[model samples]
Target: MKSTLKDPEPLLETQWPADPVKPRKAGWGGLKRRLAPYGFVSPTVILMFVLMLVPIVMVIGYSFMNNVIMTKHPKFVGLDNYVTILTDSVFHTALANTLAFTFASVAAHIVLGLLFAMLLNSPLLGTRFKALFRAVYVLPWLFTVAIIAVLWRLLLDPNGVINFLLMNAGIIDSKIEWLSSPGTALFAVTFINIWAGYPFYMVSILAGLQGIPKDLYEAATVDGANNFQRFLHVTLPQLKPIIISMAMLDLIWTSQQFALIWMTTGGGPINVTEMLSTYTYKLAFSQYQFSLASAAAVVILLLSMILAFFYIRHQKARD
Candidate 1:
C-alpha cells in the first residue's frame, strides 16, 4: 500500500491502429499474375486451330486444282477454272440469282424480324405467351426441307389452295403457274425462306432486347424521347451485333436452300432459280461431269470464302 504512492502519470495509453490502405506493394509474383488469364484461353485457341485451321487449309488446297472421282490425283489448273467460271454466262446467271436471293431474303428477314421482335418485345407482353406464339412461328424451321418442299408444292399447285382461292375470288380466270415461271419461281422460294428464317432472328433479337439496360429507356423517355426515337437511338445500336451476325447466318442458310428450290422449281423452265448447290449437284450427279463438278465446287468454295471474308471484314470495320 505504501509503495503504491508513485506518480499517477506513469501509465501510458499507447494506441496501435491498423495500417492504412495505400498502393499495393508489388514483386515478382505480380508479374506472373498478368499471365493468369492465358491459362483459361489456351484451350479455346488450340481447339480453334485444330477445327478451323485444318479444314480451311484443305479447302484452299482443293480450290487450286482439279480432280475427278476416277482420278487419284488432282491436277493443277492454274486458275483456269476461275477465269472460265467467272466468264461463264450460265455461271454468271447462277451467281446473280444467288446474290439476289441472298440479299432479298436477308433483307426481308431483317425487316420482318425487327417488326415481329418489336411486337413481341413490347412491354407487358407475357413470356409464356410470347414463347407459345414463337413455337408456332418456328415450326417451319423444324420441318424437313424436302418435306416442306413437297408440302408447298401441293399448296402452290395450279389447283392447290392458293390458286384455288385466287381463282374463286376472280383474281384470275386462269390458274397462274406459281412455280413454273422464272420470275415468280424465285420470289416463291424466297418467300418460303423468309417465313422459315425470320423467326430465328425474331427470337434471338428478342433476347437481345431483354439484355438491354431498361434504365436507359427510362432515362430516354424522361428526356422526352418518343417510342420511334427511343427505338432508333437505343434499340438498333444495341442489337447491331445480333443483326450483323444474323445477316451472315442468313447468307449461309440462304446459300444452302437446295430442296426448296429444287422441288419447287427444279432450277425451272430456264435455270432461273438454280443456286450453286443445285448447279453442282446437277453437274456431278445428273450430268456426270465429275471433274467439271469438282471445278465448279472449287469456284463455289472461293465465292463462299469471299462472301465470308467480306462479312468478317465488315464486322471488324464496324468494331
Candidate 2:
C-alpha cells in the first residue's frame, strides 16, 4: 500500500497565494441604515411636538399666570387660577355632568355594540342580511359630528318626528323639550353620542369575534354548554381585553365631548349639559378669563393622562 502511489500533495500546504482580506470601514451606508427608521418617523415627531406638546406647555404656563392673553403683561400668580377654578360652583356642576354623560354613553355603547356584533357574527343570518344590517348600524358613524348634532337637534325638537312618534305610541301625552329642557338636555346629548359611537365598538368587536377559534366553541358545546353558558365562560373571557381597551378609550373621548353638546344644548337650560370642555370654552371666549380656562384645561389634561397611563399599563401587562 505504501508503494501504490505517491502521496497526494498536502492540501493545506498547497494553498494558492491571494490578496489579504480588508475589514469594512464604517461609512455613510451603515449610518444611513441606522438612521432610516428615525428619518421615517421624524415628521410625525416634529408635528406632535409643535401641535400637541407646545400648546400643552403654553397652556400649563398660562394656568399658573393671571389674565393671560387678555393682558399685555400677564402676572405669574402660581396656582391662583387653578385655585379659583377648583373652587367655582359651575366647575363642580360641569364635572358632575361630564361624569354622568361619559358613564351612560360608555355603558350603553358597550351593551349595544356587543349585541349588534354578536348578531352580525351569528350563523343564522344570511350574508346579504348581515351586510344590510352592518350598513344600517354604521350609518351614524359615517356622519361628521357637526352633521350628527344638527340631525339630532332637528329630531329631538319638541314638534319633531320623535315626539310625534312617542305621542302616537302612547309613550307620552305631551311633547318633551328634549334639548331645550334642563331635565332632558343631558340625556338627549348622551343618547346622541351613544348612537354615534356604538358602531366603532361593533366593528372592533366583530373583528375580534371572527378571530376567535371555532374549536373552543365546539369543545364547549361538546361539554354540554348552552349558548348563554358558552358566552359567559368562553366569549366573555376571550373579549375581556378588547372590552377593557375600548371602554378606557371611550371614557377619554366621551369625557372630552363638546361639539355635540354645544351645538344641541349650548350647555344651556341652567347648565344641565355643561361639560369640562364647554366650561373651559365659555371661560376663555365668553368671559375672557383665559387664565381660568387654561387652568380648567390643565385639569382635564391631567385626568386624560391618568387614564392614558392606565391604558398603557394594561397594554404592557397584556403583552
- Highest TM-score: which candidate? 2
Report the lDDT tens digits of candidate 1 across residue range 27-128. 778867977799789899899989987766665565456754556787877776557666778777787888888899999999988888887777667889
lDDT scores in order: 0.80, 0.94
lDDT of 2 by residue, 1-319 (tens): 5588887986777668898899899799999999999999999999999999999999999999889888999888998998899999999999999999999999999999999999999999999999999999999999999999989888989989999999999999999999988888888898999999999999999999998999999999999999999999999999999999999999999999989889988998899999999999999999999999999999999999999999999989999
Clash pairs detected, candidate 1: none
Candidate 1 stretches with Cα past 4 Å from truth are 1-67, 70-78, 124-132, 311-319
| TM-score of structure candidate 2 | 0.92
**What are the TM-scores, per candidate, against the unseen true structure?**
0.75, 0.92
- The whole-model C-alpha lDDT of candidate 2 against the native structure comes to 0.94
Model 2, residue 114: C-alpha shift (Å): 0.7
List clashing residue pairs in candidate 2: none
Alpha-carbon RMSD of each model? 7.1, 3.3
